[model samples]
Target: MTDENARHAEKMKKIKAARDRMMETKTEEKGLIMVHTGPGKGKSSSGFGMIMRCIAHGMPSAVVQFIKGNWDTGEKTFLRERFADEVRFFVSGEGFTWEVQDREKDIAAAKRGWEIAKEQILDPEIAFVLLDEINIALRYDYLDIDEVVEFLLYQKPRMTHVCLTGRNAKPELIEAADLVTEYTLVKHPFRDGVKAQKGVEF
Candidate 1:
């Protein structure tokens, strides 16, 4: 082989060895509390991707949408249609706060959603639970943050993974999370007079 190819192979071999060593140290496996937050899009989308992964592995999963209305979303439709027995989906929001424009109603909706989420989280049959847009509810003080955090950290099943998705996640929730991802918005088509399109938004 050429000198360049020989060097490249040796470098890759070293990288693989280092990666294996690092992986060996990560032996503990437990359900994680994952948070997806920030101003950029794809927070809920990422949570849905994890739900898909759970479904692919034949694990039961549940979703409780806290802020998004019952608009027909692609992921929702596909999961319900294809994996009805394996997935439990609930749209618990009346609408977005700006659209609803009623503080009392919004609070009621959030509480109802939280009840549904709690039920799913505690279900022994469910291995994954996605609390979609729940951070927004907590941010607006529609739900008690302390109570939610306590239940998530202490009351949820030991092997059930929970994912919370929204823009402004609470500090306490972040501290309790095993994994946190924040999306940063560099640019968006909405700034360029583009409307929310099907299969992209919703």
Candidate 2:
């Protein structure tokens, strides 16, 4: 081989060795508590991606939508149609707070949503639980952060992974999560007077 080819192969050999060493160190397996929060979008989208992944892996999964109403979403439709048995989907919101316009009603919806989440999370058969838009509920005090954290600590199945998604996540919840992702807002079409598109926003 030429000198350039030989150097490229040597660099790749070292890279492979480093990657192997890193992979060798990740041997422990435990249920993960993930928080996806911030002002930007894609928080629920990312959690839905994981739900799809769980379905692909034949793991039972569930969704409890806290702040999103019974709007027809593409992900929900697809998951319910394709893998209905492995996925249990629930929508427990009347809409956004401004749209709902009733504090007590919103609180009731949040409580109902959380009750469903508690059921799915405690079910050992359900390996993944997506608490969709729950962060917004916590931010609005519709749900108690301390209570949620306590349940996650003591009630959730040991091997069940839980994902919370929405903006303004509570610091206590963030501290309790094993993984946290904050979606920073750089640019959004809504700021430019463009409405949410069919497949992109919903």
**Which candidate number would show the highest TM-score if scored against the true structure?**
1
Model 2 TM-score, 2 decimals: 0.93
lDDT of every predicted structure (CA atoms): 0.91, 0.91
Candidate 1 versus the native: TM-score? 0.96
- Report the CA-based lDDT of candidate 1 relative to the real structure: 0.91
Q: Model 1, range 60-79, lDDT digits (tens) per residue?
A: 99999888765678887888
Native-vs-model 2 lDDT?
0.91
The lowest-lDDT stretch of 10 consecutive residues in candidate 1 is 67-76
* Collision count for each candidate, in order: 0, 0
